[model samples]
Structures are given as structure tokens and as C-alpha cells.
Target: MPTDAHPAAPRPAVDHDVLIVGGGHNGLTAAAYLARTGKRVLLLERDDHLGGAAVSAEAFEGVDARLSRYSYLVSLLPQRIVDDLGLDVRLVRRRFSSYTPDPRDPSRGLLVDGEADAASARDAFARVGAEGDAEAWQAFYAETARVAERLFPTLTEPLPTRAEARSLIADEHAWDAFVERPLGETIDARFADDLVRGVVATDGLIGTFTDLDDPSLDANRCFLYHVIGGGTGDWDVPVGGMGAVSGELARVAREAGAVLRTDAEVVAIDGDSGEVRWREGGVDRTARAHVVLAGVAPVVLDRLVAAAAGTASGATEPSAGAAASVAPRDEPAAGAHSDEVPLDAGARHRLARAGMPEGAQVKVNLLLTRLPRLADASVAPEQAFAGTFHINELETQLDAAYRRAAAGDLPDPLPCEIYCHTLSDRTILGTGLAESEAQTLTVFGLHVPDRLVDAHGNDELRERLRDAVLASLDSVLAEPIADVIAMDAAGRPCIEVKTTRDLEHALNMPGGNIFHGTLSWPWLEPGAEAATPADRWGVATAHPRVLMCGSGAVRGGAVSGIGGHNAAMAVLEEELP
Candidate 1:
């Protein structure tokens, strides 16, 4: 709990070339790039640790299993950032793509083995009565692959106009399917099987609470990000878990001469003057910089900016409680703003539109004594659990789940996916645990929005949701999942559940929305404004000095460093002060 300044005597205000708030992976990326250019950079993190939602920890008591506690898997991170920063992290591609067991008949399942030939995949699809979908699947992904190759390279560059991006894609049919029309229409037209269609549609719903046919096209944006990672749809597992990814970024930033401080909670930011106020070790400190990079949600940034303005004008101090409260989907949090700070028209409009994002997911981490046996005896447990294991997530089932959850009720037979990190890399476990064949399962339950948690208290709903998720998992398993769960040294079950409320309290993400808010289209619409370099990069805020460098930025979702990279590029475009 070290402080940036002494408690007895506050330090004089300091100045830097660039000041970054929130020391997440994106913030660390900005610090590394900016500091390497010989610009003085300072990064402050509220928590004791650096990584935001991208850290690995031993969840079970004395388990010695370093599980990725929150965000697992890497799909959107660019190799250019890794090569530029000289990150020493390694990512392993899963041999099996995915395996989804038929909920109607547990004996039949669809297994997508990456190593298997096309004929093998066709046969696997045939087993689940989706033989025709095999060719459709290939065709759909092939189209996405083409889009990825053309669009991914532009993520780290300046923003492209809608027409410019469409022209670059060079395929009107692909554009009409993925970009123009509703994603649901494309899935319906291309795939005949319900399960196959669901597999394709799940990408559109990850961490995003939206229907495929929504006019906003948020689901389409989510799907695009899922498939365009590193110019491919492959989501690789980090060797030492997600911590390795952040650890490398931290090392690079520090080596590049960026000053990163933990346990330093930034309370206010003056966008007009580039001044930042923070609390550390019970002391208040002030710092000013030429540019400010915010690695936070837009809603949170609005509060900070307002707080700063209020302090300057001798208004009442704003409460930080909103950062920890659970908000309904597409609704503003109670006590989110203060009337003491009058907002301009632009700020008011931004807040009204942004509201508080609601994350529709429940993450569960479990340590198993052994992998569960699948009802479909043809597929081995290792193969089934190697990649994403879909459970009760057919197209019809997913729609029903969404409808139920939207009505303030829990979905029956919740749809979820499981990933076994240990199968791809054993480095996360201790030698004894690895030798004992212990495995870790990361379960991500979909369609369970924060609204449900708000209705049912987090504590009561956590247990209920855990039971429901396990029940859904048991449907596809040969034996009860509880039978295989390992016990920790404290004689407790080696399972941990994290709800949206838990995320809000732990990560400061409003409503536990992982992407900070809704995903934005990568390109700007026709007649849109891009007057500044930051705007051109799609990282601009209302103020010229402040820029977004996190998941809130356009093209800035998932574990990708594109947001940070693009923000830095925008700053570098300006002449050095």
C-alpha cells in the first residue's frame, strides 16, 4: 500500500508529457509506446495489482493452480504489438476447435477437430445430423477470413471511412452479409441446422447483450471482432495464463521508462487542463500532463471529468459509489451524476447515450480431479475439453434463454461454454498437480445479464446460478460434475463463481461490462467528423487533450492492444512539446 506522496506533507504538483489513468493492459501498452519515445509518462492504477480483468491467480485455497480468474483466452491481440514490445509470451493454439453435444440426444455430438481433415469434419457433422452445415460452416468462415485479412491490418492504423473500408474489403457480398444486413439474416440464409447456426451466432453474443437482428448491429460488430483477431478467428491460450500477457506489457513499459504506480486511485481528471488528482496512502496528490490517456469506460471518464470540474468550481464532492453499483441494462446507474457539476450539451448527450453497460455473463472457475466423461463416448474427454465446449447452446435454445433472461427470469438449462486451460499448457499448475493429472475448467455462462443479478441479490443469485450452470453442464456429462471436482487444502470445493456484481466491485467496470460498453464499428460513418489525429484514430474524447486507450475505444474490445497502439499513434502525430 505504498503512496505516491507522503501523508504528512503533500508533494508539489508534478508535470509529465503524458498521464495515463487505469493500469490495465491497454494502459500499459500506451505507457510502453509513449515512454519509448523519450516522453515522460506516468500511469496510476487504483488496485494493488496492475492487470485489469486480465490476471491469473490461485482461486482455490492452497491449490497451487494459477487459473485465469476473469478474462481467459487471447483472440484479438495483434502480433505487431508483441513484436514491437518484444514480449516473451507464448500462445498455444488448441488442436480441437470446439465440441457441442446434442442436448436432445446426449449420445450424439459435433466435434470440430482442427487437426482433422475436411472429410473428418464432414463426418463429425454427419454424426449430429448436420452434414450439410459442414460445407456451410466452411463457406461462412472463409468469408470471415477474407474480411479479417483486409480489415484487421487497419485496426492499428487511422480510422477508415465506411466507404473506404468497404472498398478495401472488395467483396460486396461479404460486406452485405457481415456488415450491412442483420447477422441473423445471414446465418439463416447460409446454415440450415439449428446447432450449426448457433455455433456461428455464439460469437456475436460473447459479452454483448444483443440480438443478431438488432438495428444497432452490435452483435455483428462483436462477431467481427471475434473472427478478425490476428487476421484469423483462432483464440490461443497463453502459456502461463493471462498474467503473462500483462506481465510482459508491464515489463516493456517499465523498461521504456514509464512510471507505473499501484494503490494510486485517480479520483478526478481535468480534461481542459490535463490535470489529474488522485489519492494514495491517505494523501492527495496532483499531476499535470500535456496529454491524458484514459483506460476506462466512457461512463467512468465522464464522472471523473465532472468531479474535476466540480472541485475547481468549489462544488460538492461527487461520490465514488456508482463505480461499484450494479446497473440495469441500457439504464443509468442510480446516483451516477451530481447536479453540482453542470454538464455541457455534448457531455449530457454522451452520458444519455452511453448509460451503464450491462454484461451478460457469469464466469466460473473450477479445479477438477479428473476431466468429466462425455455422454458421447466417441469423443475423448481431452478432446472434448481441449477447446470451447458448448452446452445447451443451440440456436433455438439461445433465443429462449435470452427471452427468459430479458423478462427478469433465469434461463432454463443455461447456455455456457467451458475451456480446459491445462490441456493446452500445463505450466499453470504445480509439478505435483500436473503429475496428478489435475485440470482447470473456465466456464462462461451466457444470457445471464446483470439485470437478473440486480433483481436477485448477488449472494443468493450466485449459488442459484452456480447450481443452474452445473446442472446444464451435467446434462452433457456421463457422470455428475460434482463427483470430479477437487477439494482445496482447506477442505472446500475448488470452485469459484464470479457474477456481474462481483466484477463491478473488483474491476471497477460499470455493470461488469467487459468491453467497457457496447462495441463500436471500426470505421466512421459517412459525413462523420474526424478533425483531429485522435478522432481519425477513433480514440478521441470530447476534449482535445483526453483520449481513450481501453475497451471503450472503437475497435478496442477483447485482449487486443489495438486501442493502446492506435491511441499512441494519434499522440505521436502531434509535435513533441
Candidate 2:
């Protein structure tokens, strides 16, 4: 708590070119890239292991299932980074994109396949919607697919000027539909069916806490990242588990001579001097570097800076001509905060403007004795459960859930989605359980905002929400799902629910936001010019020596290491070839 980046006590010291805070995927990525470039790097993690929220674990005690607990799928990670690091990882394409059973008639459902079975897909869409709307669905996604192709490659490259990106696509309507207007307006104009429109709209609200009709266009930004993050907009499954991603990155970083320490909790940071103070082995320690890559939430960074402010020397005064260098010229002067200044004051201003990020998704992991029977008799459980299963997620229901949550209550059934990881990868289940009988079900509930937990508390609300979700699932199943649940050694059902509060406490994700901040468009305003090359990189902070390598940076959501890769690229002044 002393918050000394350069500990006054003069204990053992370590020196590195880059000191990375938080050993999540982003930090590991930064460390791996910088160390591979022959820069000395030191990475520290407070958790026992790395990967941050992109980790897999056995949520249920006495269960053999290793489920992707918090963050489930992979869509944002770039293949360029994968090949660059020579990561030994396997990503399996999902056979289907989603399957939604109609609550009115349980036997009816809509299924979207990955193999482009156009006739079958159109027929499925027609079951719950007009044939014309189904046709509109096809046209709409075709447009998004084009945007995906043109946009995803730019993520690894320098941040494109918004105009440059729009020019690359060469479609004014495409730009207006995705970038300029609210996504709900676009969804409304294209899709007529409530269920179909909701299916398309859900892409925009995964981790974002906002209304579909909100003018902020925050939902559009989230939708853009989801559809275009992987260059193809396809969300694949990491064969072993989500951990395979960060674990492989950790191996690469360590092999590259980057020093990594676990249980090393960073207490304070001096962004001006590029110094970090942390507690390791029950002792305070310090490290110095030319750069400090903060792979943490903005809230966490603020606390660290506030703690280190008192110890910082008279470097607080704004340096001569530093204003132009510290802030983007297109933005206001106040937007720039000198790295040499006492960051507490500036941090407060930015923190207030950034606002607190609150995640609205509930992660529920369940070990099933067998895949549940589907009410849609025509569709097999294997194919239906192979991808995302939507329950009470019609546009009307989804919108209603948002309103209900805003009014301090959970929806009647709670709009949610489910996927069985074992349907694609049996490696996660042990030998005895891998014989197709045992499986893992991961559920994500939407519109269950953080305030719900604050109002009900974790204990009372978790059970109520869990029961509602189970009942909702049963509404679409042939039989009660609870009957086929695998039991733990304690005879308890192998079901574990993690609320927003649970994530906040467990992962240190302020408000349980998986992205660490509100998702933003990858590019700056169309005509805005960057003040410096680092500004074009999008990873550089107002603090010159410190850069963001987390989800808070541009192009920095999901399991993507774009932020980490960009931060390293900025420090090394390296650009993609």
C-alpha cells in the first residue's frame, strides 16, 4: 500500500526495457513480442495463473469437466499473431452459428449452419419469420461479411483514419449502416421478424450494457468488433480450452527470455519514470524500465497512479511544448495529460469521462450427464446443441429484459444463450467421461446488469436467476434438464453460476466487464489527424512512457491481442509489412 514505484527502501531491484502489469493474454502478448525483439521484459500477475478472464477451469468441485468459465468462445484473436508467435494451438470451426427454439411452439426453431446450407437455413428462418425477412437476413449478413473482409486486416496494422477505412469499403450506405447510425435502426430497417432481428441484434449487446435504441451507438461498436474481429467474423472454439490461448502465449514469452512472476501484485506505478513497485514473496520489490505496458482496467491504473503520486518528484509540472506531444491535436487540450505530471488529477478527469464499465452477461457452467433432448423433434440434439442455443431471446424479449433489468428486476425467464463445448472438443472431458455421455454446457445470460446483483445481493439473486434460466431451458427441451445433470461428489448438481459480482470479486474486473472498458470503434473520427505516430497506433496513452495493452485500448476486446500487439509495435516503432 506504500505505492512506491521506485521503492524508497532500496531492496533487490530488477531492470527491464518493458515492465508489464497483469499477466493476462494482452500482457503476455506484449511481453512475448517485446522480448522476441531482444528487449528485456518483466511481466507480473496477481493471480496464481495467467490468461485473465480468457481462462478455463473446473467450476464445480469434484467434477472432471474443465469448462471455459468466463469468456467462452474465440473470435477476436488474429491468425497473424498465432503464426508470428508460432503458437501450437488448434481452433475448430463451429458447425452451426445458432439455434433458437420458439417459446410459442416448442417444436419450431430457427437454425443457422456454418456450412452455408442456404436452402435449409432459409427454411429454418421461415419457420419463425416471413420468407422475405429471411431473404433480408441473407442480404444483411452479406453486407456485414463485406465489411468484415475490408476491416479485420486493419486491426493489426496502424489504426486507420475513419475515412481511409470507409474509402477501402467504398460504400456510403455500409458506412452509415454500421458506423454512423444506431444498429437498432439498421436492424429494424432490414429484418421484420422479431426473433430474426433479435438474433442479429444480440451480436451488438454481448458484453455491452446499453439499449438497442440508445443513440450512443455503443451497441454498434460492440457489434462491429464481434462480426469483424477474426477477419471472417467466425467465432471458433479453442480445441483444448480457452486457456490454450494464454498458456501458449506464456510459453512463448518465457522462451523469449521475458521474466514472468506469479503472485506478484503490483501496488503502484510511476508512468513518468517507467517504474513499477510490486509485492512478491511477502516483500516489496521494484523494477525500472523504459516503458510500462499496463494490461489492466483504467480503474486499476487510476488507483496505482494515485498511490504513486506522493512519491513522484517535481516531475509533475507540465514540460515545455509537451502539450502538443501529450494530446492529440484534433482533441481538446485537456485531453492531454503529461506522463511527467502527477497523474492523479488527470486520471480523475479521464476516469469520470470514461465512466465505469458494467457487464451485463452472466456466465453459468454446467456438467451434463448427456445432451438434453430438444423440443424441436426434427433437429437432433447434437446439431442443435453444437452451437449457441437461444432461450427467450427474441428481440421483444431481449428488449423487455433490458427494460426489466433497468427497472430493478430480472426477466421472467431471462434472455440467455447456451453452447456445449464437448460437442466440438472431447479433449476437455476425461477418458471415462469423453465417451459422448458427459458434456459441458456454458450459458450466458443477457441484460442481467450489475445493478441486479447490487439490489439482490449475490446469494439470493444467483439462485433465483439460475432457477429462471433452468426453467427457460426446460421450456425448449423435451424433458427437464435438471433430470440429466451430472452430480458432484457432495451429491450437489454440477451447476455453478457466476454473477457480475462474482466476476468482479474473482477476476478484479471492476463491475465485471469482460472487455475492461466500453468497446469503441477501432478507428478515430474520419477526418481527425493523429498528433504523432504513436497516436496512430491507438495503444499509446496520454502518459508517454505508459501504454495500454488491455481491452481498454482501441481494437481491444474479446480474446484478441490487438492491444498487446499494437503496444509492442508502438514501442518498437514497427509496422506490419
Q: Please name the candidate that would achieve the greatest TM-score relative to the true structure.
A: 1
The TM-score measured for candidate 2 stands at 0.89
TM of each candidate vs. truth: 0.91, 0.89
Best by lDDT: 1
Q: Where does model 2 exceed 4 Å of error?
A: 1-14, 311-355, 526-529, 574-577
Q: Looking at candidate 1, what is the lDDT of residue 107?
A: 88
TM-score of 1: 0.91
Worst 10 residues of 1 by lDDT: 313-322
Per-residue error at 213 for model 1, in Å?
2.1
What are the lDDT scores of the predictions, listed in order?
0.86, 0.81
Tens-place lDDT digits, model 2, residues 325-408: 111112223434566655564454343333346788888889999988988988999888888888888888888888888999
Pairs clashing within candidate 2: none
